[model samples]
Target: MKRIAALFPGQASQYKGMGRDFYLQYQSVRDIFNRASEVIDKDVYSICQDEKMLQRTEYAQIGIMVLCIAIFDVVKREIESPIQFFAGHSIGEYAALTCSECLNFEDAVKLVQIRGTVMGKFGGEGKFAMANMGSASNDVIMEECIRFSDDIDFVSLSCDNSKEQKIVAGSSKAVKRLVEGTEDLFHGKVINNLGAFHTNYMLEAQKEFNETLCHAKFHEMKKVVFSNVTGRPYFDETQVYPLLGRQMVKTVKWRQTMDYLKKMNIDEYWEVGPGCVLTNILKREDPSINVKSADKILKMEGTGNEKIC
Candidate 1:
């Protein structure tokens, strides 16, 4: 069996009718959605089909994860290859942990619901915000953020998507100024829908969600998984609670995560999610690395879904 590294994507990659293919073709996909629906007390399958509802944080977080997990189940059914490692961007980590058996599917869904609800309550109506800036190096983004920060207003890097793309979050005024000042240098835009995640702007959310993460039962990983906070393999199950809690209020080391995977003897990299965000990031970092997406997974040799909706 070829050694494989599986990566799951986080929020913002979701779209209308993302996982309808899996739901229409596989019983296991519907089963996963039904299981998740019981935890959140809402119809997950129906939520995926609604574009306006999917934009909300509460629905988007859980909906994206459930779809990702459903696709992962399909991948496992079709391929028997060994997974060398597992990791996710942000909310994607819960999917990684659930697939690796660190946390059960129901528990992962519950945590995401609570996480989304807590964070969603804040940073709305222009109290705070996040922005994406492209064509600027990570150092330049950080340097500029520092230059814009002050006691009353500040901005911090939330995600290091790649060397050229970085995201910032903080007081609305600060983020606006940062984007406006750097617009001439890079493509910058304010994110109005989602809250400021992966920054101290989420401190309250982190505190509220920490209790749930600690309360959730975690088990020994059946496969190795990397940390978005540390950019290294999780030492063991003991680190899951603290690391996941800290992830809420820290920069996601995505660039570092790709660096760590390079050392491992990975034969194939598969992105099992609705969108190809992770796949695109890997290609940008190293075009030579062989990678595939769920769409291609459905067409793998000797694989076919018998049942159709």
Candidate 2:
């Protein structure tokens, strides 16, 4: 038997009508969306259908969580297999927690709603921006950013997605400067969002989010879940809140997380979410790993039921 891990994606994975097929096909999926709507007091179905709503941080966060959870639910119902581990990227962590029964769906939705609002409001206060640096070594990117730090107040690494891909977030002027300075050496593109996440720029939001986490209830994980902050399996449930809080203002150790998974000898990975972002990253990090999007699995197996399992 193969040990399967469930991977969830965070921001930048949401798309208009992302879960519409599942929403229409599965009562379980519809029930999840309905629950999400009741928890957030917003029409999740409509939100997923609207491009503008999918772009707002708050809406996007909740929308993606709901979709990921719905997909997970569908997979659980259809597959007779056991998931050995669960993990998520950034906001996707909430979905991972929910899937592992660490956090209830309603609590996860409400928490992410608050998180998105705080991050967006604080992130928009300044001209902060994020950019993807492709074909650049992490050391080279860091060196360039440091070289320009005198002019920029908040510029740092946001995510180390792979050996060759890194994300930087900071003042738009600083990011643009870095891009222009390294145009000949590396390819870079600005990410669509106002916040410079995983950096000190999110300290204010992190504080508020921590307070929110204090009141949030967490249950013992039923399955091992990796932390983006530590890039390791969470051994202590008590550390969940603090790790989630720190994740806001810390670089996402995604590259390390993938390495950890590889060490675990995970036989396969299922990206249980709206987009194939994490799937692509996993393939880039380790081509030998057997990974597939939940939707892709359904299609390849000729399941005919548009649901993921």
Candidate 3:
């Protein structure tokens, strides 16, 4: 028995004209991109065409959501499988909602657009995140995180392909402190993210996002969508709004979420957006599982199916 799980990627995973392929291929994809352009009063296509827009936080958010949604739409029409669940990283949660039908594509795009704007506004300056690669236990890293939580906030703990590799999110000051405290110091390599995301530092943006989502309409999910906050599957409409809001300010529980899916006997795992990041993470977590990037998905050309561990 194989189950299908769709993984939606977050911000830093974006690339140029991510939706152009689908936009040229699917009317629905074009319509969705056009609707997003209308909501923001900017030519999203132009933004997609321009390299600068795709790199900026705000435009990157819109482009990524549109592309991810479009990819999901293509899969829905072209492939048939018993999809067991859906999950997303950070802003990718909105993409999960669209896949689950909890929110319309237009509304989901609007939400993320505003989300990116708000994040840029309140996430403050002089703060950023860094990804650390290594083989370390969560508890050891978490203990290290807490040692600096007072200033660093230890906003996120991402389980990479294996227990030894993980990404930590926090302010520059705190991250620096943690690195200095640790032996080998991330093996001397750290990727500085554009902002301090997924930590308490973004709470102000989360507040505004919550208010906006509270007024929006969400339907009960026809399928399971996992919450990054709790690392659990939730399909109730009532829970969706709160969960999405908390996501901005909470740690992404990627490790627990995947484990939960494995326990449910998921068969296929598809990373539905740009980059093979999630696919790599899943494979590292369990090499026996079958996972593929969205490009691999499009190449399948038939039943884009696989078994997750």
User: In terms of lDDT, which candidate is strongest?
Assistant: 2
Models 1 onward score TM values of 0.91, 0.92, 0.87
Q: List the residue pairs that clash in candidate 1.
A: none
Off by over 4 Å in 3: 82-84, 149-162, 185-188, 296-309
Which stretches in model 1 have alpha-carbon errors above 4 Å? 125-127, 135-139, 183-193, 295-309
**Candidate 2 — what's its lDDT?**
0.84
lDDT per residue for candidate 2 within 84-166, as digits (tens), equals 78889999889999999999889998899999999888888347788888857777888988876664465788998888779
Local distance difference test, each candidate = 0.83, 0.84, 0.74
**TM-score comparison, 2 vs 3, better candidate:** 2
RMSD in angstroms, all models?
2.9, 2.3, 3.9
Root-mean-square deviation of candidate 1: 2.9
Better of 2 and 3 by lDDT: 2
Q: On a 0 to 100 scale, what is the lDDT of residue 32 in model 2?
A: 88
Model 2 pairs whose backbones collide:
none
Per-residue error (Å), model 1, residue 220: 0.9
Residues 153-177, model 1: lDDT tens digits = 8888899878766778888888888
List, in order, the clash count of every candidate structure: 0, 0, 10
